[model samples]
Target: MFYRIPSLGGLSPFVSLLSLALLAHNIDAASSGVINYGGDVPIGSKLVQVHVIYRHGDRNPKSPYPKSHYHDLKSWPGGWGELTDTGILQQIKLGILLKALYGPQNYGLLPEEFNVKIYKSVTTDVDRTIMSLIANQAGLWRSLKGKGIHEPDVQWNPTPFRVIADNKYDTIFGQNCSKAEKLVDMFRDERFEQLKNENLQLFQYAQENSGYEIMTHPTQICWLYDTLTVELLRKGIIPEWANALYPEPLESFLMEYLKAGSLTEEMRRLTGGPLLKTIITAMKNLTMGKDTIKMYAYSAHETSIYDVLAALCSPPKKPPGYTATLLFELFQYQNSFFLRILYRPGPDQTAFPMKIPGCGEQYICSLKKFEEITQHVLPKDLVAECTV
Candidate 1:
């Protein structure tokens, strides 16, 4: 017999163990409890454009604890925080997926030849994300080549990606937002304190098992869990103390804490404003027949995805895994445009249609209704709100 549990934060309607088991068996299986937007567009429908924002693929842990036993940087060929070969392959696969979905035969959204004006991509200055963009492009255009190019060994062409300057108020990373920091601090003290108190035993257990000191703060817990997760993924080593700690509860709490810390309505407006503005502007331009770019892609981080989800009022149950992707598809049907949102947890997984709250049974949301629902959440003046 299978049981269902309501997910926290209305992220998902239900969580089923059978679904999870199937997911484990085949990561590409359709996700359980997700509302699919159907595989093919209606007969009269045409895909007008697409905008995708995705997290970078797997990499070594960002930093190691000072007193931890996992201190050998040389052990990781990519060194600390660098993208690995595995990461590159994962992104390549994603690129192939995109090609299949948007390439000439599918939606005819992207041209065969590389055109700066036709397809545009941007990434943060960070190495992993920048490299991910390149890798993704390699996969995206693997089958297509430059005009009159006969180089036997050349299977790929250069694709341009703009690098956002790493300034204090950078939108992609949501860094150096004093307002966001203050908001997070206040929420931690007021709203999260009780949750922490209730989970004291779980936290204590983690502290005892984890080599690094585990703190009650959600961010700290998230960091610790991330570290543990990386270790398990890279090396088949689960810490000895993990056996007694009941790690699943700790993991669930960490996810809950992360959602609370970052997904708050106030936080979304402040941190996710620029991205929302970008998306909305693109969609509006498309509706007005003024949008030149056919496809837009942003290579970003988990925080970016989380904030975007929150702004849309459909926060995920937990953090997005490596190579997690959120796609915004605009379709033209009988002179009207509709939007479809899709989320894939990882590269090997099938994307699930995300139901925009209040959109009702039909997953397709009309442009006007989409704008009305999201208007309040998009930032009016990003700079002023992010000002220290």
Candidate 2:
């Protein structure tokens, strides 16, 4: 017998061991609760356009911890935070998956041929993300170019994608807010107490070894976690304490820090609300025929993923892994439009349709109801909200 537990996207988050054993043996397309990646269309609803936000692939640590051992720039050939070879491959894999799922033959969300007029992509002004987009495009083009298809003789052409400027604010990036800064300070103090009381030995060890500088901000330890994780990935040298307590309490602490940085209503408004506002505006524009683009893709960070999900009332339980994606699909049905949001946890994982809280158990939400339920999370005037 199989039991189900509540989870996002209508799939049970937890399953009994017997359920797992059953799932392992009886894998088929017809199984209830099983979502076929290519078969998620809502009844009688025709797909309209798709919007995607994905974290960059694996990379070296953006910054080293205090008294860090992995300081050599040569150690990371791509320099600080640049995409590694594995990162490129990861994005390429994602691109191929995108083509399989959204290309003309499947969901028909994207054009068969690469068309600047119908497709749009945006990324932050960062090297890893920029390269990841190019890599993903390469994967898509490769799929289009090979195997008894059109454009076999055509060499891969460059795809146009915009990059947000440093001083400007966009849907995926947060604007400056004194309130957010102060919240970070508050989170730092809170984490210090929690650590000192709960894991004092581990806390004191990481603190003394990593240096005091990293403890200045609540999110700084995440950098240290990054460094450690990269080393663990490479099978490089790591401290004994880290080997014992590295990913368990350390990862949890890092997640808490990330979540705490945007814990309050005002903090979420400044950090995550802009993206929701943008998405809503896009949906409204599509419903009104103002938007001609068929696909909108944002190549961004895990924080970007977190920002948007938190805005949607589903803050991530763990850090979004490399190539994690949030897909928002709009559909038209009988002169009305509805929405379907799915989360692909990793590059290789199947996309799970997210059943948004208060949006009911149904996977498809009408655009009008979506705008109504999401009003509390979408900021009215983002700039004004950020100021003072």
Candidate 3:
């Protein structure tokens, strides 16, 4: 839906996906201290906190396949797989929109002045994710900083983003489930065997054009799809032979493989449960006012979104796109707290409210109800749970 414009450096960025409806929006300021954002909010309730999880903006493909058209570095400004100038603009616009939708002068949801003590940001130590946090902060505050922070020439604020040094075994990402991995492995192997025979012709076609020495694994073909997709997103460099297979049988096959593990209760618990537990803990912290943070923004990957969604019993309908986001908000009404969730379908769209399954038909769920519904997937001991 979008293409990159390198010459503008994002000021007049190419009509990319992130700019569609977002750039033209002029959100009306809030009359009171509540942020409605087109959602039906109980009149007396006030937003207490928001927890955000978002994928990094558009970037070049990570894998460099054999005889690939995008092998040239000129096409990738920041080198392969790194966030591009286009992506930076996407994130900047996102921050601007977020501030407009939440800042005190606009929606009156967050504080007027920047308060470090009341906000927190974190990211995996990946280069793209870290850069996204910085770029997003630039838009969210627009050079507004603390009392003593300053720069000699640039109008900039230094926002501290804590980075997780190593997430290889982080339960919050649902990465430590050995049993779940084996189950998913078995499922994919079986599916792959059936698919291999069914799509022998496609396999032959990909083998000839995909550059992989072997087209045996489903993930390998998905990698080809990813490459072409990024190329199409950036410079439209995909060869005709490659384009023929993309976004079709390729995408359908990829989804089946990717979703195989998350289909079952035991799989979702061990594979996606840990992240849900982490979010539930944050909700509890806000309920107790234990942490002063009014918002916590996490710059992460698509898998993080999947973990939260699948564990919440709201598995995604498609691969989460670039800059796709999930927001978990807590509200206070008459001394009781409630939870509301929203999902942005794409970078250019406003997030629609989500009706979490088992939370009934309403968008808002009592904190107690929210906890009760998510309890099954929230593993008390991820390690022991993974032993299954």
**How does each model score on lDDT?**
0.69, 0.69, 0.72
Worst 10 contiguous positions by lDDT, candidate 3: 15-24
lDDT tens digits, residue span 1-388, model 3: 1223334334333223223323323444233212236555698898888888888888878876677876777767777779986677777766766676778755466664557987788887788898888777666665444543443334445677787654335666556467777898888878877887888888878878877753566557777777888878877557878767878877787777767767777777776677667777887887887877877888888777876787777777888888888888888989898988888755765577787789776788988898898888777777676775
| TM-score of candidate 1 against the unseen true structure | 0.83
Instruction: Report how far residue 369 has shifted in candidate 1, in Å.
Output: 1.3
Report the C-alpha lDDT of model 2 over 270-323, residue by residue, as the tens digit. Answer: 667777777778879978989888778888888778877887778888888888
Q: How do the residues 1-388 of candidate 1 rate in per-residue lDDT, one tens digit apiece?
A: 0112223342221122111211121112222332245734567888888889999988988876444468679767778888876676667667766765777755678876667777889898789999888878776755333453335434455677899876655764556677877786776555546655777776666665564455545346556666667777788675676655435655775566556535556687776667877887888897897978888999988877877887777778867888899998888899888888889887567688777786774668887888888777776766577776
Candidate 3 lDDT score at position 82: 94
Q: In model 3, which runs have C-alpha deviations exceeding 4 angstroms? A: 1-39, 72-74, 145-153, 167-169, 176-182, 383-388
| Colliding pairs, model 3 | none
Sort all candidates by TM-score, best to worst: 3, 1, 2
Runs with alpha carbons beyond 4 Å of true place in candidate 1 = 1-41, 66-68, 143-154, 168-175, 189-196, 215-218, 245-247, 261-263
Scored by TM-score, the top model is: 3
Q: Which stretches of candidate 2 lie over 4 Å from their true place?
A: 1-41, 66-69, 142-155, 168-172, 175-179, 211-219
